[model samples]
Target: MPLIYQLLLGLVLTLLIPLWPSNTLPFLHLLRSLTTTPMMDGISLAQKAQLHEVADLMLEIYKTLAAMRYIDAQAINPGPHNVSDLLYGLDPAVIYLYSILPYIDKDFATNTAFFNGGIFADFRKSDDVEQGRDPFYGSPSEENFEDEDGPYMRPWVTPLSLLGNHGSAIVYDTRQHHIWIIDQEGWSSTDPALEGVEDGEPDSINRNYFAHIANRPAGDVLRDMVRWYRELKELPGGTEYSDLCWDHWDMDLKSLFEKNGWPDNFDGDAFLVDQAREFCALRAKGDAENPLGEVKKFTDWKNGKADRAKKAQEALDAAQNLNETWKARFELWNAERSVLRNTEELKKAQQEADRLCPNGVCQRPEDLPLWELVAVQRELGWKQNDLSYHRDWAEKSKESDPEEAKTYRAAFYLAEKEVATYEKAYEAAKADADRLCPGRSPKSVAGIKDLDQDDTMRDVQRRTELDVILTRELDALREWAAQIPPEANEAKGMADNQIEGLDKSVEDNQAALKKAQDWIAEEKEKE
Candidate 1:
């Protein structure tokens, strides 16, 4: 037997054997003690002894294994001593032992059951067991299991054949009654048995015991083990065992542990504080990297752009309103000016009518002979020889024939005065007609036989001239009212064009601004 089993047996003998009665046989005393002791309330003496034997066997198997290796069938089969066959022969007893030993010492049974084998073996290899051959030689197939990934078999066997040469081990800390699976490749158990496994109760061992180690090299495995050991030591109230199996590993993981600023003896409180600080730093970093801040910035820019667009639109509207107002004012001013111009023209026409016809009579009332007027011009002619002879004859007659000379002279003077009066009237009429109708002419009175015939001819001439003047004035006013002024037309065109251009600009800018706002809103929603 291994020294560990010897020591355990020695302890049991020393601590529990003495409680038996001295009067009875050693076996009967043990049986009585087992039935009576609170620690062995449910287990019989025979069951307790079987549990101890299983624990010793498990210890012996563990002692024979290499570091990180399990005592599976491959490690013991086809050898000088086949522990696998031996275990198979005692399978029924072993099962009974596991079922009953928990009533006496649950931790011992649990540790022995797990470390001795059968529990954590690979199910794929165990399928070979049905063929009456080694359990390590078959492809994994799910036949009776509810889940393809769940446990496949329940027969107790060494885990070495399941693990092969490159896998890890499941270790049981007998002193602490704690089970930990340390596989090079990470492993986890969701089996119902390991759910709430705890110390002192073998039934609970199936529930609470579970652990894993990531796939790594030997050195890394050692480092991880050291780290776990330190962590366990840093737990509240600390662990009971100080010298764990880490010393047996050749790797030095102390530097690796200290490199993270965690001392070998670091407490749990310090670890918690460090983790909190790291969490806060990560949160701040996330805030800095988030795009929500950029979204807000773009939103601000969008608002500013919207405001600018609004103001621009308002300015454009004001400009358009001012242009319309000016146009209306100009139209009103033109209307008033036209009215004033018409009034002035009417006043000038009235003054012209008074100058041309003072007493409503357009001609003189006297009548003169056209022949006498012509004869006078001939008699008084200075450059003509006939008028000189006529004047001389009249002078001679005055001496020779006074009556004849007197008659001649009287006719000549009267004719001359009549011609002068007619000439003055013609000039005045021509001037009045020209002033009232600049491009018009008056009728010729030279051809009129009745110079004083109730002023009919003179009235006709004045009326014709006045009609021409009034007609021309009316045509001019109509022409002025017919069309807009050149400047006003140009101003109106500019206003229309400006308004159109501003409207287009506002439309385009509004669309662009709306697009920007929508994009910003979308981005914010994503954030």
Candidate 2:
């Protein structure tokens, strides 16, 4: 109905810029769901978590360099000196990073990894201040927007034409080099469209909305920094460089961690750690034997994405072609029926057909399982969206306007009823799809031919030639839904519940699946 192929043919083209590959995107999706969703009870704040992620890798180095610069210039309290025990228990490294995060000076450090050495050198311990959320939600007075008071007015937030430009530029590059993961707290998280966005899909997220979807996970960014730091420590001739780093940090930054306290960042959960390796071949990126599993998943997903799109196009073509065939047959049928209607033959034949089949029957298309699934899912999605909207309106107005609330509530239930109808339709279609192979989901049922299906008696009035063509074409549609490798199906099935939330169990399962996929792909390449 209504050019279903147009809906089937999605906006599947890859951006000139690379987002995460499909497999890796899901992994990143899980991580963001865990750490970033707002007002999450018992979970860590995304900003703090992001800060701490890259903290161990480079915090001391930043503090050391900042202090050295100030000391060289004879400045007092030149860096993160210390916080009193009465105040807070954060490590000096984290305190330092948090303290200086508001700097938006044109002269801000622009090192490869956004490592700060030059600018913070002049900053003093006395200058450190807690930057609450005022700056992002600036008042009409414009003090917060210009950051005139937050950073000691060091960097003017003016030049009205280029608002958020200085900060937005750092969002992605910092992640690529694996240093600073600019937090999304004051940025895209506030977007109204992002409200109620599924934790599993970052499709509408726009951390750098003006430019592109900055799809890199802040967690992965920090992980990358950690990996790089690990490599730096182990690399040949790195000791000399580290000695210099140690010397600069020793006076203040390093001592602060030893003297005060920091959040526990040790990866000591041995079971989870071991589980990760076994599942995803989870080594640090660029490991000799098992490289980054995320990258492997991404590569496979990317290479296959175009192929999947091609399959979708083939399906679209088949659907349109079938429509054309159906149209021709339909015109002939109408002409024959019209001619028959002019005579007494029409009534008797119709009576006989009616006797044979109560309602006018025709063979259900062989492709009904998946093609009907597409249509059912489409209707289901629309109904679900309608239900969500009405439900939300009902909740919001329940207290303020009881009558309006009741109206919306009624509408909500109506939508819910429609949603249930479509969902049942979808499930029925999925159930009838003969499994392509054992363990494959109905979603994975492709255009494989099935010759044995009954076509003679039931729905005997008409059966079109297009049905077989539709089945063959629908295979492309099937793959479009379940693009994950066949090996991943088990992991995915196991992960379904855990993946819904921050259940640690599914993390390991996904890792294992990624690991299996990586190994399988590697072996095939070798062959």
lDDT of 1: 0.36
What digit string (tens of lDDT, one per residue) describes model 1 on residues 1-527? 34465456556666766676776556654444444443333334444554444344443433332111212222222211222433333234333333321111111111112221223232122232232122223333543334443232233322221232323343322122233333323334212234343323222212212222112222222233334334532111111111111221321223323444444344433332222233223333333223333344444554555455555445545555555544554344334444454455445544543543344432322212221232222222322343345467679898899877866564444334334433443344345445554553222322222323323334545555555544554454345434535456644664455445545555554555556556656767999
Predicted candidate 2 versus true structure: per-residue lDDT over 363-456, tens digit per residue:
1234334444444444456668888998999999999999889778767755665565556555555565545223443244332212232223
If scored against the real structure, what TM-score would every candidate get?
0.19, 0.17
- In the predicted model 2, the residue pairs found to clash are 279-511, 279-512, 280-511, 280-512, 447-475
| Candidate number achieving the greatest TM-score relative to the actual structure | 1
- CA shift at 347, candidate 2, in angstroms? 99
TM-score, predicted candidate 2 vs. hidden true structure: 0.17
Error of 2 at 468 (Å): 94
